[model samples]
Target: MNKFIKLAAAAAVAMSTGTAAWAADYNLTISSWTGPNHGINALMWPGLIEMIEEATDGKVTAEVKLGLAPPPAQMDLVMDGAADMTIIFHGYQPGRFVGTKLIELPGYEGNAEAASVAYWRVYEEHLAALDEHRGVKVMGLSTHGPGQIHSNKEVTSIADLDGLKTRLPGGVASDIGRELGMIGIQVPAPKVYETLASDAADAVAMPYEGRVGFKLTEVAENVYEMPGGFYRGSFAFLMSQETFDSLPEDLQKALDEKVFGEPASRMLGQAWDEIDRIGREATVEAESNTITIASEQDQMLYGQYADLITKQVLAELNAAGIDAEAAYEMVKAEMAAQ
Candidate 1:
């Protein structure tokens, strides 16, 4: 009788442990529109996933699903619970995102890491009022490296861009294209290679990483770089509010404290900086592509036009009651400190 009782007790304990284990495990699905080999998918997502698993003590984890939706549809996918999380390019939605364009404006002098950290801080302190991400939990914010002109032909001066059909991502990039008198072709990053290959665009305004990430080195063999670049692009990592709310309180706290916000943003930005370095090195090693440093006079002219766009954006934001100037100053200061 005593042996039988002990056996029964052991069985009950094992069943309870199994039940607890099952309850603790949560799986999150991340939707990515970029190619799997892209830095975000290859480095950033894996790093973030590891952080999540570590922070949650193995109770929660994530997996990335490619082409779950197109880039512009990401935010809506997460909001609608079609995907648990996604990264959004602020410029992709145009008028739907105004304050985010502040980070996209030119003249910020910093690598992706510093800019990304500052972006998160600025959003928390100032841009949160815009509530542009109302339906989702903002996991983090980041900026890619500086945007430079990449083309198949040598571009020595601003005049070279005039009347050239260039691929512009959107938002301030489009605005800058207009200012420079370039005929703009709008396309997502993934399509850039084919667009250039098919002669749809003569040039593209993108970061150094594009040379390799989008296989631009094979098509666009010349890069025109300005001191601080013509502009930067803003990106956000977001989570579904409903999915987050479904997590256990402890898991939620763990994600908030360790895996989300500034930490994740910094990780992603650092990855971009590293990948950009690799891309630059690859382009140089190829010896097929040419790097053109914009002349001092050309840089000055680009800077002046960039300033006009900045002022126009700030004025619009201020008109919308966002204290745009103060926010812009804060971004500068935060980035400098970083």
Candidate 2:
């Protein structure tokens, strides 16, 4: 009788352990602008995935699907549930992103790491509860890197841009060119290299990352460093409301713990900083090119130009009945506080 009772107890314990193990399995799908072959895929994406998997004790594993479509298609794909989640830039959407403009304030930031984490925190504390983001669950909101201009022509001063046709996607790049005296053309990003190489445009205004992705150095050599990332744009990772709602509660909790809450800023910032570095390297390695960058004096003038555009932004913000003064003040105060 004692032996039979011991056997029964062991069987009950094994069955309970099996049941717990069965409850642990979770699966997810993810995608991003950086195609599967990019370093960002090799580095940041996998690192984030590993963090989630480990945090959930291997209960959750992600299958990352990259390069499924162009950048413009990302937001739509997530919304339609064609993708589980993705990273998207609002600049691609134009006037549709009016509410998120508070983040794009010029020269208004602290340490990007803390600023980014704070951005997510603030958005959740304030913006997330609103109807604006009801269709998607935002993982984070951040503008990742400082930017500079790489062009075929030297932009030593604002005058150098006169009549120079440049490739700019939209938002502040178009606004800055107009503010500073250049004639700008709005074109799809994939066509930028073709435009410049074929002489449709004399230059392009973009952050350094594209230099590597598009092999930018072969066609453009002169680089103008516009620090504080004047033209840098914001991006966010998001999940479809329906997809998120469909997840099992425990799996959803695992995601919140893994991707939400807070991640070391290093995980996010490193990918952005790498783009700038790689962009510069591509320019440097290009054959027979003179890089005429902005000096501190030139940068000072650029600062004034940046400020002037801020006024323009404020004007536009006010016309739409958005009182950006306090938010603007908060941004400046945060930058100063840093």
Candidate 3:
């Protein structure tokens, strides 16, 4: 009788295991500031979610809420239960991401997509385990492919940049802009057109190509390709700790497998390429958009800018108890590896 009862229990356990192998419920929410239908997130990230949904055979799904709210409030919104996940600027919380080696460390003049892939791969191996991201769960972090200045007037030399009230995407970019003698204006992206029309801004900094709705072609005539970029601004997708903890284990695994892994190459790389392509079209069509490739002298001068700014940034990071130099080296190492 005892043996029969034990056999019955073992059979039940086997049946449960087999059932588990079939399918299971897995669902999560992803809240984003950019419309899922367009922009950087759309350009690169959708395929990841779609792949996950299909791979799970509809047992798992990702619900994306794109452009649900303004970005400044996004971090708090996720923390407050208004959103389960969203992307926010690391620079927005100044000093928090310092020493992580990413935000605005110059000498990134070559390739954005290459740098982005390399950045994430290194961060996953080193930084994530280092408490660099303490309170938040980082889904992914990457930058706009690269930035260039599109302006009404040609910025041929240092003298050409003086007194131009340009639209600056605040933080390091604005700081650099002011340092370069432009009166920096901070207008939200949506207000750019009106600001340009009203003469509140003389120019805007945007990618070299492939911005959909921002309409750089309509307002700016000359594009000044800053050698080191005004700032290599980066964006991060994050989820509330509470929200992530509430998910079942299978769902978490699903999200990681379907979305975060090698998909970055597909999502981020492709989008930036598209944007870069589109930029070429806009520049040509505008007919007025002039590309001023930095001369040897200009390039030589930018090296001085890189030295000063990189030192200050590293000094500031070191003061806060991080190996800023190490982080900087990691970025360069990754770039060189490629």
Candidate 4:
């Protein structure tokens, strides 16, 4: 069977075995934006639900519901108690996330797993003071695998990006887009395939997983790969504060101690790594698709661009009162230790 079929089968098994024989005492709802076939829905959510159920010893369970709101609206949806839990992309809502941008910066040297575990650590140590995610309880934090250029147009050198219209998730990715002289097109992840299909944009900056998750192989037929990627996208898995407060103290303690932070983040990050690998394999299998690794000269030149973007972002975060330099170094150190 194909990987999609395998994902379906694994999800079926997880959902079947995750819950209690008796009904759960607290059954939560998960609002997801990715399509059912996407790894976030097919693997990550189910894995998380299983963790929740196990951590609470079957007292807590969650089910995912798609289209509860758009990607940018998830935090508000949970805060409003419309949904008990959801994942929000930090970049989707610009100025609101400054400290969160620490993980999204380019040149982090690790898979999503290390970055995610480090993300939770850095948030607790440095970023939580910002209260950027003030109203909701942050259950976990994660970053996707390295972001790359996906396009119908071939991009062999950094200069080739000039004047190209690319859908860039706003954050450091947009900073890079500006430096590279590409026209920035902003859109939610769900809209990428149609946007490219309609020829509204010629390229998108996303992790390898987009190859399968967004069906990029069919729309964006070429992948321009850079070492360690252009950037990593940050994500927060959130739960309603009201929902957490409503749970009994023991259940709350169980969730927090066993399931909520690093554990959950690691699980999601590992899932990202897996799906990213699958996406790469899918790209290799697609007869029409091609991946162009950046030449050494281009890599050296891109490093200069990355350095400029990094300094500018760090300065912005420091101005906002975050110890961003410390946080940035910590992210690298933590990833290295991992």
Which candidate number maximizes lDDT? 4
Query: Over the full model, what C-alpha lDDT does candidate 1 score relative to the true structure?
Result: 0.85
Question: Candidate 4: TM-score?
Answer: 0.97
Worst 10 residues of 1 by lDDT: 11-20
Q: What does the lDDT come to for candidate 2?
A: 0.63
Q: Model 4, range 89-187, lDDT digits (tens) per residue?
A: 999999999998899988899999999999999999999999999999999999999999999998888989999999999998998999999999999
Q: Which stretches of candidate 3 lie over 4 Å from their true place?
A: 1-28, 35-37, 54-57, 93-101, 125-134, 209-211, 261-266
- TM-scores, all candidates, are 0.92, 0.80, 0.80, 0.97
In order of listing, the candidates' clash counts read 0, 0, 5, 0
Error of 2 at 331 (Å): 3.5
What candidate 4 gets wrong by more than 4 Å, as runs, is 10-22
lDDT of each: 0.85, 0.63, 0.62, 0.91
Q: What is the lDDT of candidate 3?
A: 0.62
**Which residue pairs of candidate 2 clash?**
none
Ranking of candidates on TM-score, top first: 4, 1, 3, 2
lDDT of 3 by residue, 1-338 (tens): 34224333433332232332335465556666543323544444454445655655666554556556776677777777777667665555545555443555567654666667666775665556556555567666666656667777668765567788888766556656766788888765656667776778888765664234466667776777766565666666677778667766776686677666445543665556566666656576666567777777876776676677778777776676656677777777776776
Query: Candidate 2 residues 4-35, lDDT tens each?
Result: 24333433332232332445565556766653
Give the RMSD in angstroms, all C-alphas superposed, for model 4. Answer: 1.6
| lDDT by residue for model 1 (1-338), tens | 34224333433332232332354588778898877667777677777877887899878877778888889999999989899989999888888998888898899878999999999998998899999899999999999998999998789889999998999999888889999999999888999999999999899999988876788889999988887888999999999999999998999999999989999999989988976886787678777888888898988888889989999999888877799989999889988998
Q: Residue 220 CA error for candidate 2 (Å)?
A: 1.8
